[model samples]
Target: MAFDEGLLGQEAILSLFEAARWAASASNGQPWRFVWSQRDGSELHKRLVACLKPGNDVWAPKAPLLILTVTRTTRERDGAPHPWALYDLGLAMGNLTAQASSMGLLVHNMAGFFPEKAKELFSLPADHEPVTMVAVGRLGDPEGLPEKLRARELAERTRKPLSEIFLGQSP
Candidate 1:
């Protein structure tokens, strides 16, 4: 998505992370982690932006904020595998998304990144796995996007029907 690209303040960014931190997790382990950068062309920002793949790199770099999301794959206290780690991470992301929406910020999560590269670049711990990258900012004119993307963004939004999505459980 196109972004207005207005820089987000530290307080606003912290609020987003705070919301995510409060999300419900398995046994309240709270394993989600976020690393962020503002679009100020700093070294860290460039490195984080470079973690994105081509299609994502196109629009995400233009967004005012970039965040790298991660989860602890093992129990912090015991170092055992945490089976629900990813699910907890998703919950945290959902909270972050809700908080961002309330703040008039847009968030787009991306799977098109090199997680290993992210780990290597950021020196993430072995169990702290990279999950997704996020682009955040206010909405921008679709015209700011390339022709094909602009057309797509301008098109009517669609989703599967409720009936298709909420199937009745078989007895």
Candidate 2:
């Protein structure tokens, strides 16, 4: 998704996180965590943008906010593997995106980042795994993107039909 350069206030950012915090998790483990940086031309912002792959860097730097999602790999109480940690993080991100949309903001989640770099940059513990990086801001003009990306942006959005996604036998 494309984003404008407009800055989001602290309150708005916190509200988005608040929405994410309410997402469902396995056994209420609540293993999802986020580290975010807003674009103000600061060193932190630049570092966050630098974590993105070159393809993402081409566009994501223009976003006003960047968030890194991390999930706890094990349960806190028992120290067992949390198989659903990634799924729970997905739920939280869904909440975040919905909240952002409600506030007339756009969110683009990208996997095109160096997770190892993120770990180094954020000083994440051994039990935490970086999952995704989200770019957030207001919608921007597609014309600002490269021709290929602009074309892709204008392309029709599609999703797999139930027939393709479901496992039940066809009638």
Candidate 2, residues 27-117: lDDT per residue as tens digits? 9999999889888888788778878998899998888889989999999989999999999999999999999999999898999999999
- Candidate 1's residue-wise lDDT over 81-144, tens digit each? 9999999999999999999999999999999999999999999999999999999899998877
Q: In lDDT terms, how accurate is model 1?
A: 0.92
Write down the TM-score of every candidate: 0.94, 0.96
Cα error of candidate 1 at position 8, Å: 1.3
The 10-residue segment with the lowest total lDDT in model 2: 162-171
- Candidate No. with top TM-score: 2
lDDT, candidates in the order shown: 0.92, 0.91
Give the TM-score comparing model 1 with the true structure, all chains together: 0.94
Relative to the true structure, candidate 1 has a C-alpha RMSD (angstroms) of 1.5
Clashes of 1: 0
The number of clashing residue pairs in model 2 is 0
